[model samples]
Target: MSRKLLKLKGAFDLRPWYQRNDYLGWIMRAKRDATKVRRLQQMLDELRAGDAYMNMAWRPRR
Candidate 1:
């Protein structure tokens, strides 16, 4: 979990464990600098929004 994202009202913790784990592995697997940055940005955006994961619609646990 990102310290910055963690500061956002448990945004990282809000995600499913599988999503978090898989995203880390997927993001770290990027071979290009731009790809890593893009994936990371997408992750941050998704986490911040709390309404989507990997560009797919998602509803948080209520």
Candidate 2:
């Protein structure tokens, strides 16, 4: 009887230098946009809720 040997394949280093740079740039831009979007959404929600304290403080008395 002969036994067959099995070999395991190793994982590939997926990104080269150029691709890594491109991905890093994309990630940074995405983070910045996400922060801005979150801030804007919070402001919109506050406005919709009619947060009286915020409105009274920001608005000038006539």
Candidate 3:
């Protein structure tokens, strides 16, 4: 897998990027598990709501 880097401000922990990613990956594996659907959506929402630092973190370096 390609490395995913996350740039966090001094206010944030470095763990969330990996934790959230791992959780999302786990959710994908349970394609037919209805119990996790809501959780998956919640996580997706978190990712979408990420701040400016996160947005820049994922962008390709110029």
Reference-based TM-score of each model: 0.81, 0.34, 0.35
Worst 10-residue lDDT window for candidate 3 reads 2-11
Best by TM-score: 1
Better of 2 and 3 by lDDT: 3
Backbone atom clashes (below 3 Å) for every candidate: 0, 0, 0
Which predicted model would earn the best lDDT? 1
Candidate closer to the true structure by lDDT (higher is better), 1 or 3: 1
Off by over 4 Å in 1: 1-5
Q: Per-residue alpha-carbon lDDT of model 3 for 1-62, expressed as tens digits?
A: 22222332221243356665676576777757684786566554444545423224442123
Candidate 1, poorest ten consecutive residues by summed lDDT: 1-10
Which residue pairs collide in model 2, if any? Answer: none
Model 3, residue pairs in steric clash:
none
Residues 1-62, model 2: lDDT tens digits: 22211110010123234533543454455557786566444433433343322123332134
Per-model lDDT = 0.84, 0.36, 0.49
Superposed by TM-score, candidate 3 places the C-alpha of residue 40 at a distance from the truth, in angstroms, of 0.8
